[model samples]
Target: MKAFLILEDGTVFTGTSIGSAREAVSEIVFNTSMTGYLEVLTDPSYAGQAVVMTYPLIGNYGICYDDMESARPWPDGFIVRELSRLPSNFRCEDTIQNFLEKNDIPGISGIDTRALTKILREKGTMNGMITTREYEDLEEPISRIKAYSVKGVVKATSCKEKYVLEPEDSKLQEPVRRVALLDLGAKKNIARSLVERGCEVTVYPCDTPAEEILASCPDGIMLSNGPGDPKENTEIIREIRKLYESDTPIFAICLGHQLMALATGADTFKLKYGHRGGNHPVKDLETGRVYISSQNHGYAVDPESLDPSVAVPAFVNVNDKTNEGLKYTGKNIFTVQYHPEACPGPLDSGYLFDRFMKMMGGNE
Candidate 1:
């Protein structure tokens, strides 16, 4: 089927539908990652956006079940320059096109993805619509795109119910560490990381109350990554403020990082186009070591808004010098804007999980 990606700014690019034929309206952004399209699609952080892959060729390696970050795809749509006719990989379960069809997600291929990426970089990301209709019939969608806003995206993507994940390797006789994870649309690997370290993980919904969480008597708390503006979640911020006030060790990632900052009276602002790839270079301020990381968030904590006496920068992005991580003074709390679970990319910052383990252990 034929399709056209129409931006709110009156830009239109014609292309062919490669997957589901359904139309999609979303905040269109571009990703520069050369591989791991499957991970990109399933990441909850992309819940309200449509992705344009700048790598030119996608689905070359096929999709693998192990590469999925969440239960299903999150991106409203996909744009790629080329779709591999035959995906070749040892662990390939199915082709990307088939996966998209199964998940009811739309995709467009055979377009100039590089040009689209350049447009986003120069003009900043904007709302867009992917439709099978001709350009002449795009008036309604254009109006729709202009009025579209991502609201309640985090609540929509978050888990509906809480669950527990025990250690993968139960043979170890070590003392089981109890960790309560506040799910703001968390990835599976975050829980896996805790389970692998012998921590019994209890994942709560985004709206889980602070009193209920503390009543569980957890050794530590983990705030997870999700979609949309952190400030819009006023209730979550209030709960986090209460959580931080107590002695329970807290570790936050992505959206969790932003919410925690807001809880501490700091501020956060959205990026121009946002960071959404696996090759972001981040430097640990404390160790002065650079590490390649996977990032997928549109907001960053404002360093100037933070109380210097209460919190300090732990890491920063080398490309833009934006704050990447924060360390709270006189508290067992820390947060990072990047993914440390590695997922489908570099594992340089995997030590952050170990640091969480130490925090939980020391508090015990």
Candidate 2:
């Protein structure tokens, strides 16, 4: 069936429908990863957005259920240049077409994704609609697209109940450390990363209070990545302030990184076009080392807004010189705006997880 992608700017791209026939309107963003489409689809961080894959060909390797970062796909819609009909992989269990149909996600394929990405790059990210319905007048859809905003997405994507993940190695009699993970729409791999390192991870919902988490007597705390503006989570930020006062080691990622900054009196702002891909390069200030990292966030901590006495910039993005990580002064806390537990990206920054383990005294 014929589908139309109506942008907020009134530009419409015609394509063939690939998923559900239902219409979807969302903040449109693009990702540059050539592979890992499955991981992108399931990542909780994409909760309120429709993703445009810049890579021309997608799903050639098919979908492997083990690669999923969350329980279900989170994107409001999907856009791609071409959709692979026949996937050839030894571990393939399902095709992208079937996955989208089962998940009820609307998508458009065979469109000029390069041109769409160029427009987004020049004009910044904007809202758009994907529908199989033909419209003679684009005024209504464009207005609706412009009016859309991503809100309450953190609450919507977060886990409803707390759970625990034990160490992956059964041979280990007791876990090396106990970790309290505050899940702000966390990807499953975050817990798995700690578990693999022999930590008993207790995953808490985003709304869990600081006192309750402190009562658990965890050796360390982990604030996870999520969706939406960090400033909107004032209550949670207050709790994080309490956590900051504690001596227990703390490590945060993405949205958590932004919230940690806000809790400490630092400010955050939306990016013109947020980083969302597998190959973003970040440089560690302390070591002067560059590492290709996986990232997905729309907001960033304002380095200038940080107080020198509270924290210092630890890493920076090579592309835009934006803040990528921070180290709290006189505190056992460190945070990064990129994904260390990369599901579909380079593992160069995976050592940060080990650094967290060290902070928890697991290495000792």
lDDT of each prediction vs. the true structure? Answer: 0.89, 0.93
Q: Which ten residues in a row have the lowest lDDT in candidate 1?
A: 166-175
Across residues 320-355, which tens digit of lDDT does each residue of candidate 2 receive? 999999999999999999999988788888889989
For model 2, give the 10-residue run with minimal summed lDDT.
167-176
* 34: Cα error in model 2, Å: 0.9
lDDT of 1 at 108: 90
Error of 2 at 200 (Å): 0.1
Q: Give the poorly placed runs of model 2, Cα more than 4 Å off.
A: 169-175
Q: What is the lDDT of residue 193 in candidate 2?
A: 84
